[model samples]
Target: MSLSLCVITKNEEKNLSRCIESAKNIVDEIIIVDTGSTDRTVEIAESYGARIFYYPWNDNFSDAKNFAFCQAKGSWILTMDADEALSSVDKYKILPLLDNEDIDIYLFHTLSYMGSSPGVDTASNLNIRLMRNHKGYQYKGAIHEQICNVNQQLIDKRKVKIEDIIVYHYGYLDKAVAEKNKAGRNMKILERLLREDPEDNFHLFNMGNEYLRLREFEKALEYYRRAYRKFMPGLAHSPKLLLKLVMTLEALQMYEEELEVLERGLSCYPKFVDLEYLRACLFHKQKKYTLAIKGFKRCLTMEASPLHLRNINEVEGYRSYYALGEIHSELGDHEEAYDYYLQAIKAKPNFYMPLYRIAENLLKRGRNMDETKAALEKFFGKNLNAGAYGKLGDIFFSIGRYDSAYEYFLSAYEQMEPNPNIYYNLGMCQLYLKHYQEAYQWFEKIEGGRCCEDAVYRMALCEILSNHIENAERFIQLTPDHAYNKRSLVYKAFKNLAVGNPCGMLSDDKEESNAYVPIIFTLLNDLLKISAPEIFEKSLQLLNLIENDEVLLKLAKLYYCHGYYRLAYQEFVRSIQLFNKIDREGLRLMENIMDLSTGFTI
Candidate 1:
């Protein structure tokens, strides 16, 4: 009934200690087999009181593994590599599973965090690591090795439905794989195996995986096709092979082939969430959004199961929800998209992919600024990130709350450093707040990035607004000479007019006859299309109802977004003026008119 922990290692000083530490308390005996060690690997093993044995170096993994197993004294053997560890929960379940004689082998779900987003872990969910010594099980293959004739050896693998045990492996990470030259080493051995048995689907599959690790996606797809050609009839490893082919096809932008593979796989593995997810993703990529929405909804209906193909991906919850959000956002259903994005964020608080869509949908949802501000506050209270805080700052800045925007910009700076665009935003906040020195400092932080041109131009404006003529001359030299443009002239002229400089207003008239509102109306027009396309496309009908509160409110949002501050201010003022001439009992409506005009959040 005693268990032996068996490990095979070579130059594993960094990982040996952790692997031994996780098992020392549970196993009755610990065995370490080293082919060679030029580090403290053997010493660390000896320190843990493990029985150490040495074998001559041969570039064969299964041979080394089988050699270690033959030396085990306990009735059952638990084997893991030096770079792998059993999680705390899995460690506790080992003794109970080892005590039960009903199962001949224990399979662990190996979680590998190696995808594009490495933080979101996935697994193969079917690794045979624990088995009875008397079962006479031995390893096979020279690389990416596994039990010889696994289906024949572990015929009763489905008898126990235990999914709690897990092995966290770090070796597949980009850094780890590159350092070990693992892909190259695996490629050499797998090619040798294929030469010996040209019809071996398992060897073909192994070769495909090695190329995938090296990012030779086209070659990987070719090998997957060869393997699947032989194995498709039996559907042996259909889940793993189909996932590999589809992912490679995606990398090659072959959405049609990807869909074909997924559909074929789904016919056999009907309830597979990962297949459904990839199908939905391809539909989204193809701009078939309505179909993508259907695919994503189907993903959520799938039950959570330990069944996984080559890649362990769970789509029954947040992943599916996030995809749905993306589809709705693309289709211009901003409100529905926002709701799905909120649910995705709720499902996984640390997952940041959904956060940007939430912020973006909030900005363009056609809601009043008050509602947008309220949602931003709620989101930032729960999750503080650069996007959320920056968008909130943008909303406040648009609505003329410069002081409030300044505070949120500071919060955003903490999360996203070295972002020159946010620096420009902070400078704009300071400039409008009349903190010229502070705004100058923020603008100076930009050197040569995305917003550098705009920052330099704004620096010149800050100088002109402050009446620092000498500083303005210096900024004129430093900037791209944008201050000489008619847009800049109009901005400066109207701004001075607002500050009670009648001479400044006359100066604009003398400089050019064109009106300021007409010059910058395009910026306002663009905002209308982005934020409220329905109202923008049918503006003739809406504009005729100038006396309507809803029309005035929508116009205000567009003007605010476009930096037509003075003109927008005049419209709000006119709304109030017209309201006063109409009714006396509707003071509340008058107050709302004043609020919209005066940039007051209501």
Candidate 2:
């Protein structure tokens, strides 16, 4: 008289027995309606003494489930699936709910396990699994079927509570999900539902979920947007649909649109921390650090509440610390960043990214080099993904530690899945270190990929700088042989200066503008070292045609670096005349550099 567990089965032979076994003590009666099982599913159910009835194979899940519901003699009905089981903790919490006559429905939280090297528990979803049988409650829809209680007014939080009754779901594991082909099957049914009532946002939202599962983000966005527009105007719109739609927008990198959606939904669903967390990420990506900080901080203030019907993938505890740490680190707040990164490590000891970043932040601060080395040692052993290692390399590279950067990048290349970008970075570090021949070898290792053009261009620079003029020209010819862009042009000019010729004619104004000071300041400094009188003469002549303040300022720095204090002083004097045209920041930078370069000629 207490609880009747209702289940619908197909060829669930492998799963039915375990599911029934787990439910034996939880429910008084087991009512299973089989839709055609060729396996030992029925035999296993019989061993559990489940009252089984046959319904000819109908693709309609709700039909079969409703048939089982009708046969349940208990006062309350509990709908369950063959792939799910009640958690031990939840089993105890649920028993007390059955005796409460005032409660008409109960929402059970379902936790799915994602199949990977080590299975991960996904987010929680509240399902109407338990309700009074006298309320005329039955199932609806074919796929992702739901309970439609006739006494819907009693579904408020006061009468219906979401208990901590966890249902562990294995339907999303790699083998199970693929074997079931959930997305493919659901899409077919959802399309039919859409065709019948084209404007029905319910079907549209479901279609979006199927495509989202399959990673067809553009299609998902199309349907999610259509559904959002249809349902958003009314007070009865589903919070889950809006949240899922926002996720689709994020997958598409439509951050601006996602921000808009989040703002619209947050007012309606303020308690949803998942939305707040995503809003924080979106803000961080867009570099709105202040707003992002606020959003992340808000997540810490929320109590544990129900997330939407999608995968419960949001980090439950202090996971936002990792993101907050990244934002602080970018804003140059090392103290705050270091603290958050440590907190993140505490929250998830196995998480590799924060460990890697902690090393980077410590190294940047230069105060805790020993700790930085230790963190890197731990990270190197725990992670094989190239991104974390590559990022560490980038941090070193930015701080003028060429040898260290090259070593990290090479380590990344050695263990990573043969990505050409890592190869490109190795070549780039050697180029910065002025090991031209060594740089060429790294670039030569990659034969093809999206980074090929960039690698070839750098390789050509190496060849030209190493005095292999013919090889340089050959490498350049092998490339996309269009007009020289900024990088290629600067390197080509250096080649001309090296070969006792003038920096050749540029392709266009765009190419000329592209040769920024940072790209070739080192090349220019090297060219000034050439003892040949003609080379220095041509270099001076090259500067005559380019009279920008940046060039003049960089020339001053070059002169200072090589002890031409008088030449540097003269250049700085000339640069100051054009300082009015620059921004305030640029003006201050020029003055600071001029002061540092000022000295008597040696």
Candidate 3:
């Protein structure tokens, strides 16, 4: 019984060699069905002794595939794509399967890879890739086509068996180029189909998929939602359809809607790991840490191979460890968090995310500053990207190394287009170094937004510090309610002292009397080492009494202002370490204070 391998292609020059090479010794004849090729694809196929045939480019993929299958002359036919190849073990297994006359249709597992990762070990589904030529099998569908008649024929006339052989798919190699071609090809067919049958849900679904391939998510979602609305009620709740809906919701950033879709999908297909993993992500995004942890753990227990979900064993192990690390970090279990992060690195040493996260945890603990610094430096040395430089600057800023922080921040700012936050940070660094004129210039570059208010207020203070009294007073008058409002008032008082009207300044704003006094004392004492230590100790005591995080944080900054670096670092670390245990408002307040004081010094 001679075996024939048939493949359909159009400009598959790059991948055709691998496919043909894999089948060279296994088949008696090879047939290449070319829809059209303007390249050396046909020449390459001919070099492998493949009999070439040409067919007009039809809108239906199944029609093309079926046409190729019909022209094969061997007793046994194997259908494969130009981007697919048979592994040695699969080839060995296939030869024996082809010899078995009892088996009419044989299923082979397909593995698809994305990115630079290794092919996933798990096969999600089996396809009838090998069949008897005389079985009268044919393919169906126009876009995401499938072979249907063979299954019926096998059941009616002969026995069927599933082979352990696997087909490796490299279609996602150079995904951008392949996706561009696929989108163009599919859109042409789908547009024609939709023009003829506008209301067909399947046509709408195919069109949506084409749009999704183009990353035109909003338009894709419109068609998907339309398809779902038209078909969902009558259709038995399918995990596939539900998964698609959940993904659409995720892309739209409708977290609540995504959760609803996931819950519904989970109820219908409880064992589906894809749905579970997505649910976990939704929970993580919502900051529902406990639920997210539960879902991730459940996904780990599923029967599906990690590879089926586009994860290798290494990636799966690392993901589990990373998730545990994040959960523990949030729970204030720093020791456990650190261990899990190490485990994640062990699982996948080249992974940058775990290393960065682990360093962040170490910085919070304050016990591994040198180690964290080394890790960050190593990361930056290996990846000289803008993000790495920014993170390094952040580490320096956090530890009060203003000069080093400024250098790294400036490096990051210069290497990339300046973001408002980066400019604000540079401005803050200038202010800390007492470069009043330079600091004012940097702050003026900031536009008003959630992150720009503090910088704008600080710019006003720099005007006062540089003795621009009129500009200082104008800025102070224009200032609205902000975290730096109290600081602005103190700067105004300092401006008065710099001139000769301290008495007049002291008499105004009596309603802000309680807030301004300690701040003024802290600033004055910061200028005097002897009094600064005493004021620092008093502020620490006040911090203990304050129930509000904002108040505590303000007191902590006062301590820092008086050159109490150790105490300031301790307070900021405590706030960050307890981030998960606090209420939302409290967390936001602490985050803001940490952002202001830490600037990224390790």
Candidate 4:
């Protein structure tokens, strides 16, 4: 039983060598069908001793692949792509699987990496990649091609799953997708295919997949729903469709609908632990702690679903353990939360979330920098790297340890090249430590990176705090107009105060006031810590513009709680006079103020 590796290529010079080298020992012949390459793809194939066949560029992927298959001359065929490689451990298993006579075709688990980096997150699916040649097996579909027979029927029942033989596909990595314009190309092909057959379930599902990849969630949901209406259980993509539908609904904030679809999916494939993990996450989002805990614990007890059914890795181990830790943390069970976080670290030593949590929890419990660092070292052993240190710095910054966080962040930057996150964190640490000029310098390094807008906002604050009013106004103008940032009551108030345009605060309406009244007080208190007394007075004036008794009272309560008696006295008096009411807390505050002033209670 000889295996012929057949691949169709177009400008795949970067990846073809790896693909061929991985399979060189196992395959008898390499067949390369070029679809009009303008690069060294054919040259690379020639160097590998591959028998090259030239095929003209066609819009249909199935046509190109079928042409490649027709040129193969071996008894068994293995389909491969230039961006994929046979797993080193699993490559040898393929030849042994080809010897099985009863199975005409074999399915291999394809691990497709997501994001710009590999091994961080992946999605797995089974594909019919190896099959007996001369059995009339052919490729179908225009874009996301499928395998069919001479009569155009799927070869489903004759296929056997070989778990030991795996394929690692790198074409879906974010950088690769962007460089090759795969989403745009796939969208164009899928659209043309859908136009030809509007009711084709496979086309609709693939169209949904393209939209989902592009993050056009609403459009994705529409196509997914349409495809799901005609979904067949026997189709290989059925599970993927269900999972994507649930994810899209969740993205659209249609939680109720998401749960409904999740239940239906679970009913169909109860062993899909990833879906159960998602259900637990949804429960946690909705604050249904009991159900969330139960679901997560169930994930811990259950094994992984079959490779064909697995959408994500570690659903039953580190991911679930980390999630349980978060749930316990939210429930205020610190000890239990700490225990779960430890277990999560044990399960996946390099998982950053639980490590950050453990560090933050230790600091919150009054552990000093030395103790916190010792604990983290114990948990991570010798596996900690620059990325881990950066995360640890973020946790320290979160708990108000600016000096320690700054040290760790600087160390991380020294160990690794300075990225936008470290720049932002280092700038924030300096900002908090009141080294305004140093903070500005760090923020300046974030030129066009992911944290540019946030850095610009901090740059404005740095200028304002340093009394460079003109520079502050310029930076404020440069701040990105994100709705969540621009429309923030605190942000608006700060920008106005920085520009000396106190009337800019007047544009905030009752709706903004009503929505922000609960938390705005604490935000204002933080603002007061960084601003002058004049700015604090201006904030009071803005509060008066809202005409909210609750807002002023809450502000006064925050001041009193934090022992700012003078500020509390002013707020209490303002609230009492403006709203014409006084609660017991206000009366006590007034009495305390009077006692402080004259040694007598009012």
Candidate 5:
């Protein structure tokens, strides 16, 4: 039997060619129905020798798709979206499935990519893409369309499942969604449908899903609750509705409510690993480690089934392992944590969190940096490219191991083309090491956007630290007027100090101060380490302007931890003067130190 590939389009110039090219060799004819074409969609269709039909834009997907299906002339019909393509493995394997006369329809696994890159964070579902032509099958619904029979009812065909048949869909990706304005269009259509039938749970559930994707949690929760109240257990989307509701509640931090819904969902779908995974996550959040561990272990016992339309496959493997690792780490079972983290890495090599944890633990234990690098390199096998090296550098940078980070960044830079992020990372490492001129040169290489702005600021600060006051002022003046530039607390404090008047640099804006004070403190401390005693003394005057006792107390502890006894003592005295009873334990420690000093009394 010959097959006709049917697709409906509207200005799908970017995606139409891919869709047609993927199935052209397997199908007898390509039938394209264009609702509207403000671009080269129709031209491209003609170039592919497709039998093209024109239909007016009526804002109804089912109607447009049904029109396309009716025009198919082959014995069998295969329908697909403009943004979807048949997988190479399944392209040549379809005709055999059609040889079975008992099957009226074929359900293919549809993998919807959620990000720019393929095979990363995909949502999978089963979809009816193939059916006998002239079987009176047509699509229904205006927005999230479904298949129906001649009687305009949901189709109840003899269906065959072919797990090997796969379709890759890219319309849901963030960039694609934004370019198509899909969310706005879908919300409009769904809202119109909801107004006509306010209590329609299917539409309500879809509305919740749309809002959830848009990250409007409160609105998503509202629609999800409405759908849950209706709770049509027999419907295909009912289980998904409950899952989405729990996820919405989780996003909103309504954990108690999420647990209630999860328990209800688990009652209905006892083996749904996603629900169990979420339950474990909630338990982990609440520090109920025993329950969380049991739940996560239960998840690992089940395999992820594609029958669950929204099954996140990782929940049954790496995600659970990672969660277990986090729990073990929290409980201080470092050895157990390390084992689970390694298992997680083994499950998904590109998953970097486990690698991060392992590296952090090794560094914290004072393990040799070279040995740690060797351990991490084993995960990449023989394919440790420049990008992988950059990722390693990023992980070390995140954990404040700038020396190790610099080494990796240098390795990445040597092997790769020019990259602004690598330059910025290198600059930051040098800046932290008090190599101002080297940092300035690295920062100078960055050219555009927010990273450029930050690099410029750092360059100015580097010049200031190197005593090139004129060059520093010139660099500062070149920056745009933003909080990180002139208005920043660091800039304001430094400017005041440069002018020999550091007393009034602190602003009365507590929120602004809270956000920027630590940055200023770190900068001043770094300057002090480089033997800038004059700037260090001026920074003390700036600190005196900050009247927050908590800030002063934290600074004292930080200073004491770094072995700056005189600075720590000064901060402790100031902290005590600000709050009479705070940090008493710290005070007792100081007194003990003083008593020991008396052994050298002259």
Candidate 6:
């Protein structure tokens, strides 16, 4: 039994050498099929002692691949793409398998690396990459092409064995460029095929995939839904079709529709981890944290490798832990949430999500500025992207460090295009620092985007703060659905006072004057009602102006309620600083009282 390595190429000069080098020692002969190369790809193939054959660019990969297979002289044909290479272990396994005369077609696993994320190098799948060179074997389709109709051929010949070897695919090396090229070529072929066979479900599915690759998701959904509708009941249902439909629905943010499709698929195939994971994502997006946690937990219970689990720490099933952390955080169980987040970080050291959440919780507590800043700095070090910088700005702003917050917010905004939230934050920070003109400019940039309502309100506030009363009134009149409408009215009263309208100032009743805290508390209370009530109540009381000593007493209760045993234990450390400030203020007041009394005695 002899083995020959076969590959199809088209201007694969950058990748051909690596592909051939990996297979050089394992195979007996090398056959290369070039479908028009203007580069040194063919020359490089010849350098590696490969028999080069030329074929016209027929707009079909399977045709070119089959042609290469037909030309191979060896009994066993091992096929690979120009961007794929056999691992050393796989190389060793292939050498033994080739020598074994019992095998007809050897199925090897291909691990495709779509992007560079730690602990997630590849997604694995099995393919008949190595096969016996008989006249009966051939390939099919144009895009996402496969060697099909082989089961009967194998059974007739009595030769088929699945190998445990792996091939690493670097085809997605530069995914954006590759997707563009692939989508263009595939769309042309699929369009022609659809014209010839208008009602073919398989072609429809492939066409849908081409559109998806092009990011025309709505078009993809149309084709996928057609395929699903045309699906035959007794015939082996298409897994790819169902998966693609689910994915299209997910991309559209049609969570309810996605759930319906998943439920239908699950009714047929009960234990599908992919569907479970997708459902979990949808629930999370809807802020249905408990259901999301349940779905992710169920997915973990299924038989899957660590690599197959998305955003999960495989060792201890930490996706659920992290989700629980988020839910707890939302609910106001800061201590339990923080512990889960810590566990998630411990399970997956490089994961930035858990760390960011923990930082957010600390900022909410208001006692750990130095520690929270340090944690954020470490997070930014690891994930130095726009989102991280934006988060840092949010943290600083929360603690009233407006200058530092503005610097970070500006860095995030200018480092990238002006995102609405970044501009919104930048505008608010500027308002606080009394840079009214600059604040208005930032708000102006957000006027046309999705953040328009918030932007308009902020702009109105900036005008009032700048004592531009008439302009402020005009801007406020321009938008009717401001979220902070009551706050805006109070600000308008203040602006009226600045412009000498004593009657306008007098109209500022308790409803308008004291609206900010209640509005915030209402929103927080609603969030708590959905998730964690105790923590929400704690956050409310902390920011409430009930009493000087009452707020301090509630902070300890908040920590205790959330199971932040460690943080609760250290509450006195925080109180000591507050106590010192209070004592100094008391002394100043006492001195003033004594001076007043001495004046009366004189």
Best-fitting candidate, measured by TM-score? Answer: 5
State the lDDT of candidate 1 residue by residue for 447-531, as single tens digits: 8787886676567656655666557556655645446654555434433332444322312232243333443343235324234
The C-alpha lDDT values of all candidates are: 0.71, 0.73, 0.68, 0.81, 0.81, 0.68
| Greater-lDDT candidate between 4 and 6 | 4
Off by over 4 Å in 1: 115-118, 148-162, 233-236, 306-310, 366-602
What's the lDDT for residue 53 in model 6?
A: 95
Better of 5 and 6 by lDDT: 5
Model 1: lDDT of residue 255: 75
Candidate 6 residues 336-432, lDDT tens each?
A: 8888888777766656577657767887777466777776678557656777678778767765678878987887877797577788888878776
lDDT of 2 by residue, 495-570 (tens): 6766877664443354454454455665565444433345455545445444344667667667766656667667
Better of 4 and 6 by TM-score: 4
Distance from true position, residue 525, model 6, in Å? 30
Which should have the higher lDDT, number 2 or number 6? Answer: 2
**Candidate 4: where is the Cα deviation over 4 Å?**
43-49, 151-159, 382-391, 394-400, 412-428, 440-465, 468-602
lDDT, residue 589, model 2? 44
Per-candidate count of clashing residue pairs (backbone under 3 Å):
1, 1, 12, 0, 0, 2
Cα lDDT of model 3 by residue, 1-602, tens digit: 88899999888887899998988898999999999888889999999888999988877888888888888999899999898889867686777776786777887777666564444333244567898887877778787665566545435435566665778887654463465486787788888878888887877877786676567878888888778776553342234456666777777677787887777766755656777777887887666888888877776566664222332333236676788788888778988888888887776666656665766677688846567667667745665777777877776766565667788789889889868888888887777777878878888888866667667667666775666889988776666753257665555655565565533333233354556556554554433332334423433332222133343444445556655555555655566565323334433444544545665552
- All candidates' TM-scores? 0.64, 0.59, 0.58, 0.74, 0.80, 0.58
lDDT of 5 by residue, 1-602 (tens): 98999999888999998999999999999999998789999999999999999999788999898888889999899999999999987888898877887888887878898976665587777788898888888778998887777854655544545454789999988889889988888889999999999999889999989999999999999999998887867788887888889889988778789999999888888777788999999998776899999999998888774464445657889999999999998787878888999989888977888988998777666678888888877877787888888888888876667788889899999999888988998998888777899999999999965589778878877887787877876776776664454234566567567658534646566665665567667666666545567766666566555544467776776676555666666767777786753455577446644644554431
lDDT, model 4: 0.81
